[model samples]
Target chain A: MNTKSDILIIDDDKDMVETVGTVLEMHGYAVRKAYNGKDGLSQIEKKIPDLIVLDVMMSTDTEGFDVAYKLKNHELHRYIPILMMTSFPKYMAEKGVEKFQHILGENWPVTEFLEKPVDPDDLIAFIKELLDEKNP
Target chain B: MDQGHQLIKDQLFFRKELMERIDWFILLRWIAVALGLTGTWTAYFIGYPIAIWPISTILLFCAFYNALFFFTWRHYRLFRSDDIEYYIIFAHIQVSLDFLSLFAIIFFTGGFFSPILLFIFFHILLTGILLSPASCYTYSVVVLAAMGIMILLHITQILPPRPPLFQNITLPSSGSLFDILSLYAIFSVTIIVTAYLITSLKVSLRTKGRELLRVSKELDASIIKLKALYGMVKEMHTCTDLRTLTDSATKNAAIIMGVKACSIKLLDDQRRKLDFVSAYGLSEDYTKKGPIDIGKSPVNLRIVKGDRFSIGCIDEKEAFQYPEDIEKENISSLICLPLRVEKMIIGVFCIYSGTPAFFSSEDVDFFSLMADLTAIGIENIRNQENKAWFVKKASHQLRAPLNAAFSMLDLLEKGYHGPVDPRQKEILLRCKARIKLLGEMVGDLLKIGIKRANMKMSALFDVDVKKKLREVATFYETRATEKNIRFQLQIDESVPTIRTDPQLLDHIFSNLISNAIKYTPAGGSVSVQLSMDNKKYIVFDISDTGIGIPDSDLSNIFTEFYRSENAKECTEQGTGLGLVIVKEALDGLNGSITVESRIGKGARFTSRFPVPV
Candidate 1:
């Protein structure tokens, strides 16, 4: 099997990043990692990935969204689809943040949102669909 | 301030009425001048005659006076209607001068025999209608006396007697003394009688006007107090701190009482002293007079024991509380009310004014109301803080570590960590299930916190009810099929769209459906029906053939952290908070929910929302 499609994961939770990364690597995919928005941008600068799985909240409340917004707008990395994840649908609902789907349109930056603790099977399926859409 | 505004409004209304009356008087004066000028010119041209020169000169003088009267009316208009008192006084003086001019014209014509004497009666009637009866009666007496003096002067030859213009016509100079006496007697009786009748009618009118003004002032004062109460209630909603609440309460109390200053003194932790917590319209020195010792301050001690204290003057300075401070602040009157939550006295709300006897029994009643509201607000804040602290430290801290453990377990279950034996795998599956249950409990607790902290219905958006029902049904479709249960939906076409938080509505339906499927045995069915209930409500009924709630637990099912014994046994993963969250979410929608259940049969939950949502 050709594990050629590269996926970059940016999350502040160390254990979540490790588990999610190991799952993707085991599923025949090349996985790269960054802890926060600043390092994530630098990782993309070094080499662009085929897909990105980003966290909605990291060092700050919306740091991961900021990184995804930047990458989606940049000409070089605009083609890469983003899968946004957060453990805070409950937390952010109380904090009065509008839902991610309402903030951005379907044709724009982030492709989808998944609530955590990130299920390994769902994450792989989302990555495969995004990659297949890009190739098709 | 309200009273002042109302009084100004009353003045404007009175001024408008007076302006209309003045317009009529101005028109009458102009008409009299026109007629007087025509009669004088007619006599001079026809020679069929009267005393043309004197009558002409007097009429010209009358015209000049009336022109001045019009200018005075114009000047009155320049003054704001707020200065209506000045306008009333001006009307009195102007009408009196009008009576004087009428007397002068009658004197020039033929005294009692002059036809112009009748016009003086019209002026008397106008005065009685427009001016105070005292002024009107004064004008009446003046006109009668002036005419009587003129007739006497003419008959006794003290003033010049004019020649009769016609040969046949008899003048006052030609009449006998007896005829003149009878005329004088007749004019006196008629003028005095007219004045009596008109002034009598005006007496009841003046009394009623005074009564109306008094009632308006009382109403204005009461309205101010009501508004102050409303403002206090609104301010209480936004304040979470005791000091902030007390400060705002005292300020509003001062407004309601119309006092110079107000202060709140709370019993300190030991309950032995009254500390000044907040004060409005008070000097720094007064507020800083230090806390009151229950042993030393007699007045405060009495208030602390729940007795209201009112003092009109500070004569016995030593006996009163804060003697030197009260004298220095120039406080002439004082009212102290005990702020009580139920029977327990919490603090004292006091009002101080520089005017003696400023506060009455009515003021006491208002101050007591203010104190009661303040106490309730304080109690609510205290309770909210306690609940928030308990939820925060207990649930949130417990959830963080639980979340980390769940992520690790997910990795292990997926075989990302290592290989596992069949026995170890069984144990892992049980652990995962228990962990999921723990996580759900934490989530439910956090949901309660969110509901309490910020579940404002004002932030709701329009939601498609049919679409939401479909989404919730689809979300639970797999779970329903796993249990071999029939999941059904009966939605009416007339079930209108509702305004609510979409996530909350999803939570409500999800909890109800999830509980239904979880409790029901295999082959049992669950159904959701949405329809319009009459004209005012949209109703949702969720029913299932399930191990229904025991009748004893029905009342408490909607309370937080309550689960039936059978429910717990059937599903060890149940959080027991589903119905609590559902009830809170319904409260946010301003809706009502009811449930019917039997122990072995089933349960049906019916929720109704008001239309126009």
Candidate 2:
């Protein structure tokens, strides 16, 4: 049964999502892309992927975090792994109090956080590790 | 010291006023002596058979004392301003002499029923004003006792009783010793009652004055706090020019403080001069007195170095540089307070009054608070000013383009563009590296400009030091692994927790650790060691086996965008702002960092922060 691991990439930046999706597809994984949280949620509803690759580097700091939190809290998709692309965990520890209140947690809703400008090989290896752990 | 100085000033005022009162007292005694002589002569001329020898002798005695006091006061002032106790004693002596002379006049003219007896009330009032209540009551007691003695002597016939000077002085027309004693007793009671009334009235009046002062000071403080709050809320919506904002604030300061004028003078660092920036309630001619050179005016120089001072009178001394000019402008007194945001002095705020010694100690305290608020307000407005706002917004806008370009170059450099010439590939690699550095620099500028303003007020929290360090160390470990560098992290088991802002601690560790990883060559070691120093502080030692800083460049490493010669050659990847941000973040935590390096042997940065007391 020629079944490939399905992956969904969600990011506000269309080019970033396309490039990252192209790299992931090159690694023999079937890929899907969504530009915002709404499209990402609906894409998951159509077909749950093996792993969800999300980008927390967005126009607003909390939008990405809100998506991760919703996915983590969902009854059906709570177990699905989310690989969050964010510079925030290191770039700025916490911004203002009001902005950081929801983002301030030792246990982030995502399975792992990857810094931006991530190396292509490192990206493949991290996704492989998350997919293997979920399927194996 | 200020309290003592205020005391001396008050005493100076009291002494001058008392000296004038003494001059008036001497003049009045001479007038009384003249009246006595004329009254005695008239009694004789009208066939009253008055004794001339004793009355003339008494008059001459009064005149002698009057001359003595008058000449002494005119030639040599006995008491100085600080001699407040001495002035009290002088007043007592003068009052006592008057009482003795009055007693003599009353005894000679008539015993208790004499018309001159009313003079005792005036002396009692003076005593109440000059001396404390206890001393005033003592003087009244002495006067009454002297009258009793005269009556006693007359009754015993030891001193002959003279006829009443004023015939039919009272309705009783009584000259008997018992009537005199009864009248004398009543007179003594009246004197004591008058003294008690005057002293009590004086005390209650003083208490009310003190109450009013306290209420006024409290009211002033409330207004200052409210003004600061209102300014903060209003400034958020409107980005006003610095001069326009400060000019309005200065104008309000004058109205609130009830001063003649208020002004601000900012320190011009390059010129080493103070420039008058904004002034309210001052004439244009006065404001155009030109910038005051710090070298020429030691007062302003000290103020720029954080000093608060005041000049009581512009004509009195050279406490300010343009004292003469200010005097011509009808500004008599001025208070110069350093407007300090944190420990740095931004400028001087002056409250000018047309009256001498206008600012009280309370005024200094209130203005000092206002100056702090003003300094902070100026910083706030300056932060949102065109330059700062542009840097913040422009850097943010620059970051997006840089990142997009970088992402595209990163994809191409990763061979996603497929087969290309070796030379072309080298050029693309260089472009990627250059773009990466540019991106990091853009990020660093954002950190310095916007992040700093947001994190100005450090949010302190009790941090598990081991946890925060491990988080930062683990993050850098991966980066070090990618660069083929050996990274080691050692945390002492006995490492105590710290009360500091988590972001600041994270910022320091992240920047310094990243630099260590970025600078070191492949196969070199980078290590982070956390330990306690004598239980006073927790120390973080971040060492790298990399190209060390030159001896000459070590001092300038923390300056903004300052990169060492070796660092720039080894890596064109640095933003040259990592160490600067590190040092500043460390300083915000009340921590210090020191670096020691050898040419080829690597550098170790040791940072120490105080433990929670």
Candidate 3:
């Protein structure tokens, strides 16, 4: 297994992007940054990243959910792992997840949800766990 | 002031028509009185008979007074259409008395020598024109009855019998009894024909007037309805409550289309279900069945486009199918309008009629306009609610990260996380300061959201005014002393207890005191006073000899995200939500606040809370 996995960071906040990007980079993961959902979708099109870190609130609050829905519906991207990120309470995150399920049905592509200002060590561990999952 | 003046003007206009009718009647009565008095005086001066003058004058006076009284009473009860009947009857009575007086004068004054008879005849004619047929007949019958009684009395020798004025000039031997009877018959036939003609003409005129009035009234009602619709359209533009706007629009649509019921169902974000938020003319039991899930229902097949459900009507041959429940409720006709906001269909507005083919293209157009307005209002409310929810949730989530950062910084500062080098210590201090700032920002955001959402504090209890003031003053005393500022609390012992959220009260006081300390110079003083006003309100005045607010900024100090220029220059750490929170909290308690300030001298804030009885 590779020590560093390619991680895609999608967020509108410059401070958040810089801080989280640096944290993951220091932990030996190749990190990519996208300023918005549009750029993040294009980045996914260019190459299928190992894990996608998406912000629920970008240009719009539901942009992240919409992108995730589109990805889950696409045949090629349906199997890719996606992680939702938000600076909202756990209940709000759950609501977003439920809404996503409502849109794409029970079979969704989301692997996990992370709160903003993520702990560097915990993020790395979550990524490793997703990578270790059996791919069907 | 303008509104007050307009109200008075409207009241005056309401009385205008009634006033005009009364004026005409009053003038006529006055004229009659003057004429009657003049005639009686002339008769007396002419030596025409003292007894006749007094009787005629008395009758004339009575008639004038009665006419005036009747007109006034009718005017007062004009709102009752039934009172018109009484008015017509009274007018007939006046005319009848006038005719009897005219006949008596003619019979007594040399057999038609006096011209008053002609005046009385024309007056009766006018009365017939103004009144209904029944009243005219009543007046003519009374006149005939009076004449018959007079003739009978004369014939019976109960009264002096007077001959025809031309009897002296004619030879009675040449005139036969047949000639005399024929002349009497001619006069009787003429009077009856004249009365019939006048009465029938009046009846025709009254019927036409009544029909015209009915048409006019219907026109006025339709105009009022149109104006109300215009007002609703203008109101919809400014309305921020989705339920209220939808309810008004649906109800108005139902009325305009003359339908049995109307409803507005908003699709959830996922578009899998519809929630009925407002409805009119629908049974309560039906509304309580909860929102309908579109995917699982058979009715969806009729409305859905492919896999997407249609929000409009459903018909077999009409490209849409009507729901069975709608038909069961006797709603055969319907028009369903989809409400789209930002290109996403968010809701449907529907109108249901009991008659088949009741809704037409014109109705559909009007309903579309209504739906457009409803959609805009719903969008505004949804956006506002979402924004409030996001802010609240974001602030709550921020607390955890902020706490973690603060704790970690605290551990580093206390040397608990191993020995820190000078450079590391400097970084740790900076981190601590930034984290503190972030915590304050989060608190400010939360406060603003709570104020905007009108969130009420959970804890409420009876708080002694004096005790509360003392505690607040004592808590801030240390900070005041540290700045070398004199702090004092003056509590009126007579002030009573108040029901309030103590924690919120504490926050209010703390913010005010902190602001006072922060703005006050080293030697300035701050004082807290509590007293009862004439209204029995517990007035709390916080006066600080700190830099006062400018007059221009005083009015906006309590607005969310608003900061006084002076305050902004003094501190950049504030979130500008403290005063907004204070204002909202006071409003929830049915209290009020006023501020007085003199720049560079001092400031005083007075809050008045109604003392619980």
Which candidate number has the best TM-score?
1
Write one digit per residue (lDDT tens) for candidate 3, span B195-304. 68887886676567557656776688667657767877776654444555677777876776577898888777777777888889987666667877776554443333
TM-scores of the models, in the order given: 0.54, 0.45, 0.49
lDDT of 2 by residue, A54-95 (tens): 876455645677777787778898888998775442334233
lDDT of 3 at B552: 98
* Model 2 steric clash pairs: none
In candidate 2, stretches whose alpha carbon ends up further than 4 angstroms from where it belongs are A42-50, A57-61, A69-80, A87-109, B1-397, B450-458, B470-493, B514-529, B542-545
Per-residue accuracy of model 1 over B1-613 as CA lDDT, tens digit each: 9689877877776687777887788788788878988977887788655767766777777778778777866776635545778778767766866776677677666666777778877877888888777777787788777877887788778995453543455766667889888888898888878887888888787678868877987998798779879988998777755666777888888877788899988888899988888989888888776888888888888898999988888786766667887888888998998989999998888999999988789888878888888889988876775665455445644654565677788778667789877888788778888987887887787777768776231244588887888888888878999989999998888877776677677778889889889899999999999888886787889999999999899989987778889888887778889999888878866788999998889999998777653
Which is the winner by TM-score between candidate 1 and candidate 3? Answer: 1
TM-score of chain B of each: 0.57, 0.40, 0.54
* Chain A TM-score of prediction number 3: 0.87
Off by over 4 Å in 1: A1-3, A69-80, A90-96, A99-109, B1-15, B18-404, B416-421, B452-458, B464-466, B501-504, B550-565, B587-594, B608-613
Worst 10 residues of 3 chain B by lDDT: B304-313
- In order of listing, the candidates' clash counts read 0, 0, 8
DockQ of each: 0.27, 0.18, 0.07
Each candidate's interface RMSD (Å, one decimal) is: 2.7, 3.0, 6.3
Model 1: how far residue B574 lies from native, Å? 1.2
lDDT of each: 0.78, 0.77, 0.67
